[model samples]
Target: MLNEKKEMPLMVRQSLDQTYDVIRKKSIKKKRTFNPQVIIAIAASACLVVGLGLSNDHVMASINKWLGFDDKGVEQAVNNGMLQEDHHSVTDQGVKIAINDHFSDENKLGLSFQLAFDHPSMLKHVENVSLDYRLKNGDGQYIEEFIPDTKPLKGKNRYTSFFDYQNPLIDEKSGMVQFNTLSDSSEGTIPKLKDAVIEIESINIFDNTGKLKKINGHWNLSLSNNKKAEEMIQYKIQNVSSAIQVLKARSTPTALNIVLSLKGIDKERDEKLPSDMVIVDEAGHEYRIKGLRSVSKNNETIISANFPISSYNQHKKLELMIKGIEKIHLIKQ
Candidate 1:
């Protein structure tokens, strides 16, 4: 058993290990160094983390049972101390429901709630978790679909019914119902949030064989809200015309924006965008896509993305990827 001096490193290591697991499970991810901001947050939150006893890690583990299996961005944000703990729980219809964790970053707000039934065998494997929720601010309410933005869902649904198929939801996290709200709206202007509240109306879960179990209850979870780190740059409306992208070369730049057309793509079926995205300039330097932006109009979906470019900027050809398949898109000079 490790002593007090080693527990701080262990906490961060544990968090990073779990994060690596998620990224690995997502096909292929890797580890990254913690930035100074994250280091500061860990130091501040680890005030009483270390102890003389052997059960040092159990204190924080008990608080966050489901934060480990989320997407890379959200997990990093959680490590940066964006998690708002909720200890309150509600029991109804022979089931106990509790919000495990509520995490917010600059772009999105996500929460995980767990459900336990009175009878053990009543529910076995849960395939899909669904719920009705609304986000409210000091002014009023804002209702959104269960559409997720950048952070991917924790695919933890167990598969016992299908004998031939492999279980895909084999995550470290189980029994946690996860949902996120997309805050990326029209350019600029976000409602001033003194405090944020999540009001969940009902909950439902489908078993591996597609059996629906509905539990009706009212649960409210409040969180400490933070303003946008930087003010959004609003774009002016342009006149009716068509636009085409042309490739250019440079040594270094602050950012790069690439747009992809989704002329006839099905949004519902493809709710989550592919995470394996990158851009390789003419100089052979690779830049990963991080800034996610999407716009839908007249049955067309267009993605506008921005990422940091390297110093060797010979922008001739671009390589786009999804599901490990790369498609080279060439721009006109």
Candidate 2:
């Protein structure tokens, strides 16, 4: 194991370990191994930040750069070739709804659309506007729905922007067109989306007339990306017991998430994977990492961590070096 600095109290660390074990055990009983092959990163890790640190199975990405919608994670997903572009459109009530593009992985979907209004002034009276509809899989089942109280959490150390759009606004498209990034209203457990469709029931709007108007339309389009996504290629760790393995490591627009497993917690040095650590890529660029979650099993410990994403995929040969460890190479070059 890599030598470390800054240690959480032994008691607190053990408690966290137990929690992870329970979570991992329940996962073993409830789900099967995930094998998704998509794009981006140097490939040795993505903690699903490698659960491979997964919580949200219903994470829907909403990002549109040309129209000011911003989501770094999904945008990075596009760079990884996960997003698919669709110029398909439908005109209703003088509004042209165009499916700009989308990306999908592990039951989660992200989308961006452009609504070109025939008359730009029509939006002047729009008080509230939204798409009332559902996204269904090939089987016609809703893919995401209401958020249950028990929904998977966006891990504390995970990038907060993640798959969500930041403060998406509908009033600022700068032209006759209005951009929209949709999210979270539909859900399913269908494993993966083979062929899915988003049925737009209506373009619901509230104008200055103090009445809700539904612009019912025939706006249903195909949103199926048959291109398989990036797979979590497990990487290796050096100077650690054979038990330690890089199960997943992934980077969002500006963050890298890594999850690793250690066979047992008997050794004092192996008791924890500290946040006071550094990760170096092929170009000698350095990044510091922090622990997100640690699960300790009777015979193993699973740990997930994160660091800022910068020159990550662009530079190869990623390695993890323990802080204050006299330059020991923790991750293989």
Candidate 3:
């Protein structure tokens, strides 16, 4: 057996040695193989971490777009557009404003507001005023209209003037038709005066055809404290005709500051002549008196302050009325 083994050994021994080596390598590979679940879990974890990182970056990019700010590392690829330049300002107590960010270009700012006024020419008789506006991107190109509208504010008082007569004395002093004549026609009512100074509430002028005319042109208005009218002389009305009519029931609680010129003086009387006036709102209660003054030019006068009244309310419209005086120059204090 020993002799036979020796004779056939060389090739067989080489073959057996190669086979052993292959088996050892195979066993080592088997030992090193990972568990299936662990491998699957690790691969999924890596994919999840990568996906989360990408999602965070996307979220940051969206935020940057909304804010219109470039504080973060996210870069905004802004569109190429034009920029517009527009601005306007007014020096009035009745106006206000605000703006937005999408149109990041500061050149054209957006604005909007309202106005309140006491007189017609409050903002320089600006009948039809308008604003032109535009918006653009970072580049200086026009994109959209910023102020898309044009608004207008109007005067509260209407103008009127149309009475026909030859000797119709336009009281250059008061800027109204002289109170010397009364219109007995149907269009207007003239109150019979009981005093020299007539307290006219509101006067409605009429033409020869008895059509209502505008009370435009000049008017004398007065403001006064109530205490002064009480102790003063009361001028009663002697006669009222078509040429001179008094406004009735215009006397308020406050005293009046009379501003009129003596068309014809009856100085032979002991006391100052009373006025041809009536208070439309009063029920036999007389209003107090302050004082009177003739207008500087053309014998016109400005009477003022019959009552010491004040408004605690924030926004009150200021108003005053007078009949004897023909012209008024209204102003704020």
Each candidate's number of clashing pairs is 0, 25, 64
> Top lDDT: which candidate number?
2
By TM-score: ranked, best first? 2, 1, 3
What would the per-residue lDDT of candidate 3 be over residues 26-67, giving only the tens digit for each residue?
223311112221001011000001111112222322321211
Give model 3's TM-score versus the native structure: 0.15
Tens digit per residue, CA lDDT, model 2, 1-333? 111111010111122224233223322342222221211111111111100111111221232342232223344555666667776787776787767677654323456665656665655644334454455668655564211122332222211111222111233233233334423111111235667776665665545443455567767767856575454322344554454466655543334556666666644444333544567766887765322345568787665654544222543346776443323333423
All candidates: TM-score: 0.44, 0.46, 0.15
Tell me model 2's lDDT, rounded to 2 decimals. 0.43
TM-score: which candidate is best?
A: 2
lDDT of 2 at 135: 59
Better candidate by TM-score, 2 or 3: 2
Candidate numbers, best lDDT first, in rank order: 2, 1, 3
